[model samples]
Target: IAARLVISQRTAQGHVEHILSKLGFTSRAQVAAWVVEERQSSS
Candidate 1:
């Protein structure tokens, strides 16, 4: 993800961690699942 975003590894991790904290998510897997569910519902 850091490579794709052209950022440092720690920066990428920090962004993810911040988002998860704000959303009350425990892991990236939870975010992925929520995104998939949202897409399906919107479709």
Candidate 2:
């Protein structure tokens, strides 16, 4: 993921933290599940 994003490890970590906070989720797994559900509903 870091190679694809072309960002440093620290930057990736910060992005993950921001994403979690923005989505009101405390766990990465929860965010992943929500994203999946969203995509499914949209499709």
Instruction: State the lDDT of candidate 1 residue by residue for 1-43, as single tens digits.
Output: 9999999999999999999999999898999999999999999
RMSD list, candidates in order: 1.9, 2.6
Model 2: residues >4 Å from true position, as ranges? 35-43
- Relative to the unseen true structure, what is the Cα RMSD of model 1? 1.9
Q: Which numbered prediction scores highest in TM-score against the true structure?
A: 1
lDDT by residue (tens digit), candidate 2, 1-43: 6678999889998888898999899889998899899999999
lDDT values, one for every candidate: 0.97, 0.90
Clashing pairs in 2: none
Scored by lDDT, model 2 comes in at 0.90
Error of 2 at 24 (Å): 0.3
Instruction: Show model 1 residue runs off by greater than 4 Å.
Output: 35-43
